[model samples]
Target: MSEIPDAQPFTPVSDVGEFGLIDKMKAALADAADARDLVAGIGDDAAVYRVGAAGSDGPSRVHVITTDALVEGVHFDRTYVPLRALGWKAIAVNVSDVAAMNARPRFATVALGLPNNLSVEGAEALYTGMAQACERYGLAVVGGDVTASARLTLSVTVVGEAEERAVVYRRGAQPGDLLCVTGDLGSAAAGLRVLLAGKDRMTAGDGAADDPPQPDLTGFAYAVERQLMPQARLDRIEAWAEAGVRPSSLIDVSDGLASEAHHLSQAGTVGAVIDAGLLPVHVQTALAAQRFDERAEAFVLYGGEDYELLFTIPEAEASKLSPDTYAVVGQVVEPKEGVALRLPDGNRVPLEAAGFRHV
Candidate 1:
């Protein structure tokens, strides 16, 4: 006698990857017909909502929200990461989104999935770091859920508010606008490489008999700090607002310049020209790239998690920005031109993202 087994459906996540899956699932979710309050959805940095009558003036008052999650083994390595830094990153990344919308973070809720290996002291350290970041960003932790899991997982949701007129989005750039960025690029990814380089070198017999092998993270401290505890560009956004330099389009550089630029250009129905020589590179990032037998330009174009601001402004408004802090990287062009990078040698080539993917 043979036994029959029930059939199970199978599909590979890699077949579609992150963006494709988002498009599919987004198509499946039906939009509300009479949803007047919804300002932005699915594709943007955050979901925007128009609250009641706060539009006492011309523009409506809006609230923006975003969520992010990090998992052990997939996003980070336990051998190198500290609990406090992990906690700060969990909240800082979300706050970066709120900043992108030209808003200030007001509240947050945390949901944690913990494994048995973590202790009460570890939990306290994590919260301590979260609290410090909340103070820095002028936000408060409202509520959350805690559950058991095989490894540590953290999810954070943030809420922020702004005037409708002040809220910047991905889809507003026009031709002739100058592309710009705050601070340097690619340091965080280089830092991760330095960290991994140490981890990959360790073996059971490599250290003294009594002591375990430890990564000597000296001279490369800049990269390590950028990777483990990068700060969102909150001050720059605020300064821009005060200086009356409203961006025609804006995005946070969580992914590299190329990927985020593609997102901006695609949404705006425009084209872009990323200038390779104009990219700001930290000294440590350059040295790290050389150590890894790679070029710093690749990191500047393809590295993710920099948390700097990528934005476009009219050539007229570009004059208001401080050049030392904001690097004018490129320009927006007609849609037919498509997205491309202008190399130092005067060659123009298509711009493509080489950032990470998880599915």
Candidate 2:
């Protein structure tokens, strides 16, 4: 006897919207692994969890928590980015947030919604990459939930701890504080250009005609790596404490320099003047931008997702820190004049919110 096949044809997930897909996912995650720490998981206004010992001496170590969500077609494209890089990035971005707070990340939980198209092996590959990241950063993968969905979505929540005094905030910069940043900027934006160009070349019928030259990734690789697997500047946070140089204000440059400068200014109730020439530009980043016929200075100013730390220090106290590590790029001014950039050609340009906007 010949067995009859199912009558209905398989349909691609695009037919259903995000909510329908989420509902389907909830059902699949009905049976969750048992654990004592997870007070609540899934199906709630918010998931709750307990931490620390029942009774402990010393001020309850400050608990730092952050969450980030990456949606396919928005945060990443499957064609250009590998599953491993995707997993690493998913955790790196959240770790960057923890670093910005000057905290030590200890644990994380990941929740993933995958499409039918991805194989079980592909999903495991992603986990392997995330596990590698956990090993590198000294964080434990405490828990997570996985389910099927129409599109790929990854959300990670990282928990960290810090001493009360060591934690830095964005609202502390005062008048006359020197503005500084660790590492160079704009390379990530240039790397994005390279990746997009590569995609264009592959998509066009002419694989050779007018094809852009192989991206010279010398400096650009750092930026590409920053975008793929950025290291949170936790070491710098520890160094600053060791040097007794407490930042008056601090922010991570996930957005462009101008935008972060504006953030510091607004939060601290002060204005700032940044010297364009003083802005750090790595040699490779400059060369990569030149190759693409783009202005490196503009990329440094307006390019986003560099993930370096932007901080302010009192001028007198700043001298105590090692000169080899930090640069004095600007200074805080009275709130009368908004954020301005002093150009190399002896002109001043007003700064605006030109960073990456999710919405």
Candidate 3:
């Protein structure tokens, strides 16, 4: 008999990082799937497909699909993150991806990995929160699957639709284009810090047996609420449609400002220069950062889970947007410039992707 060779050593997924793993998968699967109707594939926020033949006017409308998974210890902690809030967050994260494509979320399919200890009522409470979010976003829960697991996990897939011309990708920004972001940043990360601190105190037996401790949320209500329940930027999409404005390139701030900025820069083969003074950090976020002896800008630049929309548009089309709701924070530049943050004192520093990494 011929001698058998030893099996090759297994490779660790962490060696490549999250996005790096995605790129490897993209290359490996390039020829495995049909590409006749595929519009956007693995590299973008969501996979988009052309629904039908092109109309007389132009190209056909497209469908957007995206999925995200939230694991117990990785994404949340039951000690501080309530069941209802956890459920809502699971759906909101997927919805944010749909909005990033400039499409309206229409349907969702949820899959739950229920543990043996979770009761019927506990599962029902989770569904209730999902229902509330579905109603608020005008989405429907079409179907799903339930399975047993050692730890709780939620996986949500959201489907959205949009006109071919309206769908935005993260690859169209040009040099001199203005960068804009919606609402504020950093509150979610600060809130998470506060929650974890509270959890640590409780674990150390901070209170009497009869008087279990609660996190002191006084004056940090806004930050705490933002962390528990994040809203997808569908409203911004609607407003853009009404104003006949479309971003050249767009993405959601789910992985923090610095990370998303690098995504856009690399996707478009350009560079992004964000002004530090222009970043819209919330007052509550600043106060929370102070309590922890951290800079608010650190939270703004590195804090994931903000779920705000960040996009770039031509300066000529800037007049279409309302200054009150959208803030121009930066501009696109040539790839040689790379991604950098312009400080208040006029010095520039490299902006690194130090945001949340799945691996």
What does the lDDT come to for candidate 3? 0.90
TM for candidate 1 is 0.94
- In model 1, pairs of residues that clash are none
Note the Cα lDDT for every prediction shown: 0.86, 0.76, 0.90
Model 3 over residues 144-194: C-alpha lDDT tens digits? 999999899999999999997899998899999999999998999989888
Ranked candidates (TM-score, high to low): 3, 1, 2
State, as a TM-score between 0 and 1, how close model 3 is to the true structure.
0.95
Worst 10 residues of 2 by lDDT: 39-48
Candidate 1 runs further than 4 Å off: 1-8, 32-34, 54-58, 204-208
CA lDDT, candidate 2, residue 26: 64
Strongest candidate by TM-score: 3
Candidate number with greatest lDDT: 3
* Residue pairs in collision within model 3: none
lDDT per residue (tens digit) for residues 1-359 in model 2: 99998799877776664434655776677566564655434432123344567687765456667778888887777867789988887877777777777777889999999999999988997898888888877788899999898889999999877765666677677878999988878877767776776676566635565654453444467667766666667778778878887888787887789888987886448999999889888776787678788888777888877778888989888888888788889888888767999988978888886776543
Model 1 lDDT tens row, 112-158: 99999999899888898899889989899999899998989999999
- TM-score for all predictions? 0.94, 0.79, 0.95
